[model samples]
Target chain A: MVTVLFFAAAKEAAGMELLRLEVSQSLSLLQLQQRVLQLVPALQPLQSLLLWAVNNQYAVPAQVIESGDTVACFPPVSGG
Target chain B: MIQLTDQPLDYAAITESVRDPAAGAVVLFLGTVREFTAGQQTEQLEYEAYREMALASLQQLVQEAASMYPLVKVAVVHRLGVLQLTDVAVAIAVSTPHRAQAFAAGQWLIDTLKQRVPIWKREHYVDGRVQWQHPSQEAAVAPVVGEAS
Candidate 1:
């Protein structure tokens, strides 16, 4: 299983903070994002804007994502 | 000390924590929720973060700053949940051998944190409107429905 986490504006869009999906094999971040966007339609419009991370570290779209990894998605940060 | 707290920030305590006998200067920075922004009156502010990542990011930023500068010690605190106007949203404290270094490090930490950290802020306007802040946006607002609290 891969845990997908959302925060701030992305969380609002997803309607929940996190979800765990059963993944049979490893996938790229882009593939994972596509699968997530399909399940959470409210996040469709934010596809290009959401930032991605894996296992609590910032990640790129083409980065490899494995089962048991925690992936995070969020909008641009504005903290001080 | 790096922390993400839902409770109020004790800036003085944070500043005190970084005080060192070997360091000649200590700098404290408090990011407060202001009442106005470009003539728009903000009633309150709500802050949230990807907790684990946010904390890890803070630790990395501190290590990076320490390497770039001769930092003696550093402490950072960020508040989550709803905050009223004038509330302390974030606090950063740094100690260095000189005031200049302390000032420079403090500023860089805040600027970098604003851009890189996973924490987010939502502004509650006096007109009963609210929006999520994306610093890169040009007056754009992200509308929120359910309360995340």
Candidate 2:
């Protein structure tokens, strides 16, 4: 299972802070993102702008994700 | 010192922590909540962070600033949770052997922290509206639904 976390505006849109998905094999970040959009279509508009992180580091779309990895998605940060 | 705190930020303590005998200049920068933005009256701000990542990012930025400039010490503290207008939200202090380096490092620290840290702010307007502020290159998403005014 992969744990997907959301924050800030993304969390507000998705209506929850996190969710878990059962994955049988590894998938690219893009694939995971598509899966999330499938589940939460409200996030579709933010697909291009969403920032992804894998295990706490900024992630690229092509990054690989295994079952136990934790992925987070959020809008750009605006804090000082 | 790099920290994410729920308590009020103490700029004096942060400034004192970065004091060094070898340093001749110290610069402290505070980010406070303002009352208005683009003609809207803001009542308060709520801040949140991916705590672990935010702290790691801050520490990395401090190290980077120290290596990029001639500095003696650097400290950063960011507050989380709701804050009224004019409340201090973040504080940064840098000490260097000269005023130029101190000022430069302090500015860079705050600017870079805003861009790189995984912290966020939600503004509560006086007119029963709330919005999450977005950084440059991203649009503000939909308003928070199902939340009480």
Candidate 3:
């Protein structure tokens, strides 16, 4: 299980701040994104521009995520 | 390079921190919470962030700026939680061997961090309304005039 966190608009839209998804070691970020979309279809369109960070460092879509990782998903940053 | 605390930033201390015998110039920039945005009369602003990520991004921004300029040191600190109007939201300091690089690199780091960092600010209006200010996508990779970068 990996802890997934959402922030800003993503948090407001989903009405949730975090999620823990259970998947095998072979699962990649893309598959996790798909699983998140299944859980919250309203966020599907954000998949492309959104950024994924595993344990606070940025990661690519194909990166394999470890089970204990704390994964954070952020919308295209609207800061500054 | 260093960034610390969400409390009110001390500009003088930040400036002093980067002073060195070899450094000829230092540039300090502070972003304050303003009284208004668009048309709303903002009473306060609330800032939140994934703290660890925010710090990493800030460190990366300073490193990038240092590499691009002859800067001897850099420090960036951003506040979190509730902030009143006119409260300091962020502070950035850069010291370089020359004034030109100090000024230029200081501006660049602010711009890039504003565009790429995940910090969010929510505005509280005088009438009790609240709104989230979203950064423009087009300028995320480009500099916009008068942008708090």
**Which candidate achieves the best lDDT against the true structure?**
1
| Models sorted by DockQ, best on top | 1, 2, 3
What value does the lDDT take at residue A9 in candidate 3?
Answer: 67
Q: Which candidate is the best by DockQ?
A: 1
- TM-score of predicted structure 1: 0.93
Candidate 1 lDDT by residue in tens digits, A33-55: 99999999999987767878888
| Candidate 1 lDDT score at position B37 | 97
* Residue range A1-80, candidate 2, lDDT tens digits: 99999999899999999989999999999999999999999888777667888777777779899999999888888887
Chain A TM-score, each candidate: 0.95, 0.96, 0.86
Kindly report which residue stretches of model 2 are placed more than 4 angstroms away from their true locations once superposed: B137-149
TM-score of each: 0.93, 0.92, 0.87
Q: For model 2, how does the per-residue alpha-carbon lDDT over B61-119 read when each residue is reduced to its tens digit? A: 88888789998988899999999988999999999999999999999899888877889
* Native contact share for candidate 2: 0.59
Q: Which tens-of-lDDT digit does each residue in B1-149 have in candidate 3?
A: 45546677788888889899989999999899889677779999988888887787777777667668998878888888889988888888888888999999889988887776778888889999887666664333322212123
B-chain TM-score, candidate 2: 0.91
| Per-candidate RMSD, Å | 5.6, 6.3, 4.5
